[model samples]
Target: MQRKFACFGGSFDPPHFGHLRIIESVLNAKEIDKLFLVPNFLNPFKSHFYFSPKLRLEWLRILCKESLKVWADKIEILDYEVRQNAPIPTYQTLQFIQQTYSLTPKDKMYLLVGADNVESLHKWQNFDWLQNNVEFVIIPRKGFRIPQNFQTLPFCAMDISSTQIRNKLACSDFVELSRLIPQPILELILKEINCKKIDKK
Candidate 1:
């Protein structure tokens, strides 16, 4: 049988419940054989991350582990993009996966993106090529509405943001942390933030 794969790439600065929820919803709705969570070393548009790439990768691994306990399916966290020295564009990342996996005509590949990304798809590298290539699995965000012409997955809209989580951690707001993030990922974030504070002092 031809396997269907969904490529979900992001910073995953701390990998919150929102991220996991979206992954779970996608799996529940689609016939996806595997959902590859690719953490980018540096997103071309973003300047930097709250956590290091190595730390973010570790967080992703922890997320996959915890997710399996709940989700119980193919959730593969890949370092394909992070391993690269330069910031690779979305089209190139998709292309590399297509080639590396030896995807056959029968197989299907879909790029999982936020509704916000759909609005700015034209700004991405080789936008035309990307549009012509793989299908997109759009997840709705709080402020962003799904586009009329695009197909979207059935997702519970999450208002969570990595930036908000980082800010809460910086201020040591564990109450908000309990609500927005998973326990394992929250521990990791606290550990890293505490270590950085100790290093500074």
Candidate 2:
């Protein structure tokens, strides 16, 4: 049987419930054999991050562990981006997967993104190559307007954002953070916060 792979790349500085729901929704809806949750070392579009790439990878691993409760063997946290010293574009990452895995012609691949990304899809590096070479699973973001004719998958519409979580963390507001963030992931974030405090001292 041919295997179908989907790549879900993001700067999951601290993976939260919304992100998990999106991944689960994709797994439940798609005919995918494996779903890779790749954490980028540097997001080309975004400039600042609260946690380092290494810490982010650690958080993703914690998320994968928690995700196993739902889909036992489907979720994988890939570190291809974190291993890179420089920023690598999404298209290049996909190319590396194709070459590294020696994917057969019969094997299928797809890219997953939220509606906000779809709105700015034209601004991405090598947009034409990305569009022509890979299929996409556009996920719906709470506020962003999705374009017509795009195949959007159902993700839980939570009014949560990574930025909001980061703000709560910075303010030491664990109550709100706990509501939006997963327990294991929150534990990892607390460790990162302590490390930052130690670095400052």
Candidate 3:
């Protein structure tokens, strides 16, 4: 039997509630049996990160452990890109997963992408191979166009963002921060919130 898996990669600078909701949505998806959370050492799309890659990875693990306890066995925290200690493309990550798990040609995995990245899909590294091998699951965002080829799940998409949380942390806005961040790692992030400086771009 082919095991269905999904990959949701992001910078996850602080692993907020928004990230958790996405994970829950994808895991609840009937088509996905397992989900992998890939935290970027540095998001290739931008320059500089607000927190260290190690810290981000740790926060992700904690988020999964506390909030996602129900999915302990169903979720995995991938450290491949973080281990690389640099910005790594999605194609490489997927390739590694494919080889590591011995997924045959017939065994296809799902790749979660934001709707904003839909139009520029071909600009991605090895777009053809990605489109052919794995199913592209679109996380709907208003004002962005989703292609017919991409799969859409009944995800409870939240409007929260890491950028907003970063601002809140900078200003020590605990009231709002408490609501935006995941309960498990909220204090963990506040403890060393100044680990690194970022552009907030």
Candidate 4:
């Protein structure tokens, strides 16, 4: 049987507890055989704000190591988006995965996103192409409503975000964030932050 996969793409400037929770939830739900945690090389919309792809990939690797789920694949980090200097469109990434993984009509490929993105789906580049090619698994975000056209899955509304975690780290208040991320990933984040501070000095 062909393995079904769900692709969750983001800059993941700092992998937070919320992201790990979503991955665990999705995996435990058995919605897909495998999950691809795709970290963008450069996000077009959020280009002004993001960490280097190398750092983001490193953080993701640490998160994966800490995750109990073994089915999550880091294939997205190795994707063309990371290789190309230019911004990679989401539809293009989906197409490449489809061809590379030999995904068939019977084999499902879900584009996992947060509820906030679901509401703004129409604004995404090649939105029509995305709707035609892949199904979606949306995790609820605080204060975001489910769209009418898309089917909402039963997922926890994770209130944490990478931005919030970064802000906390900036203030040296990683205690709350520590509770969110796995110990291994939290240690890595702390180490990276300290290294950056030392370099700045």
Candidate 5:
């Protein structure tokens, strides 16, 4: 039997507990053999000029360790998008994975995204190609309504976001930080916070 895998792509600027919850929820709902957490190297549409790619990757590694108890190997961080040096389109990423992994039509491959992203899917580059190749498993985001076409999936009404986590960190709200991210990820963020403080002086 072909193995089923879910592909979740994002900046994961600071992979938080909300991300873990989504992964866990997906695992529970499907017979997925693996979950590919593909973080973008340099998102064309999204502004990642703040955090370095290495730091983002490290934070994600720590979060995965704390929540999943598994290392980076299990979570494929395909940095192809970032390394492309040009605009990294979503359809290209999906196509590369299909070719690299020999993923046939029988093997299930899902593109895990949030409701906000699903709502904006039409604006994405080569969206028509993306729709034909990948199955989108969308999770809910705050203040975004799921479009009528996407109401069929096993959607979770998660209201958390990475932006909220970043805001809490900026305010030195360590207590809220712990609630938002995994213990290991929180430690990584704390270290970055302290480093930034020391640099200012």
Candidate 6:
């Protein structure tokens, strides 16, 4: 029997509540049977990563175990691009997935993307191949409009992003940060980064 699979790729710089929301959303979704977390070595659009690929992948697995209570069957942390140690394009990533899983044209891989990526999606390397090979599952953002052509996942507007979390780290407090990030991940961040935090009273 053919199984359904979805891929949610991102930096996951510091997996936060927003990421948790999406993770839960996709896994709980009836349309998907399993999910693959493809953490990038580095996003082609970006120059650097605050955390190394190894750490990010480790944290993601910790997130799944501690917070999501997920196992290998439910979720997989793929290091295809990270192993290559280069900013590989999404197109290549999808091709790798397609070939890896023996997916055919009829078995279209469900590709998850944020609303922010919608506008520039057409500009992504080999966008034509993506359009034909996968179904776009749009995770809504505050300002962006999801095109009718794309499928949308239900998400309440939360003005949180990985970029926002990084910026807040230096100048902002963990009290707020604690709420944005998952408790398990937050604890690791506090320990690894040597930051302070307060238990909510």
Q: What are the models' TM-scores? A: 0.94, 0.93, 0.92, 0.88, 0.87, 0.90
Summarize candidate 6's per-residue lDDT along 1-201 as a digit string, tens digits. Answer: 557888999999977888888888887774566688899999999999987888898888888887777545778878998999999999898888878878766564788899999999989999998887788999999999999988998777589988888877877578889878887787777676663334332
Candidate 6 wrong stretches, greater than 4 Å: 70-72, 195-201
**RMSD, one per candidate, in order:** 1.4, 1.6, 3.2, 2.4, 2.4, 4.5
Cα lDDT of candidate 5 equals: 0.74
User: What is the lDDT, from 0 to 100, of the residue 128 in candidate 5?
Assistant: 88
Which numbered prediction scores highest in TM-score against the true structure?
A: 1
Candidate 4 TM-score to native: 0.88
Model 3: runs farther than 4 Å from truth?
194-201
Expressed as tens digits, the lDDT of each residue in 6-94 for candidate 2 is: 99999987789888888878888998888888999989987776688888888878777766566757777778988986677999898
lDDT of 1 by residue, 1-201 (tens): 788999999999878988888888888899888788899998898887778888889988887787666555677777888888667898888888889888887888889888878778889999898877788878888788787777788987888999898788878899999999888888777877778889999
**Segments of candidate 4 deviating more than 4 angstroms:** 1-3, 69-79
Candidate 1: Cα lDDT at 108 = 85
Candidates sorted by TM-score, best first: 1, 2, 3, 6, 4, 5
Q: Worst ten-residue run, lDDT, model 3?
A: 192-201
Clashes of 5: 0
Model 6 clash count equals 0
Give candidate 3's whole-model lDDT.
0.84
What is the RMSD of candidate 3? 3.2
Candidate 5 per-residue lDDT, tens place, 1-201, comes to 877877888878778777787776777787777778777776667755456677877777666766676433446656666676555777888888888889888888888877777657888988888788777777877677776665324645656677888888889888878788777767867888789889999
Residue 53's C-alpha lDDT in candidate 4? 74
- What TM-score would candidate 5 get against the native? 0.87
| Candidate 2 worst ten-residue window by lDDT | 63-72
**Error at 51, model 4, angstroms:** 2.8
Q: Write the per-residue lDDT of candidate 4 for residues 1-58, one digit (tens) a residue.
A: 6567788888787777777777777777655666777788877777454467777778
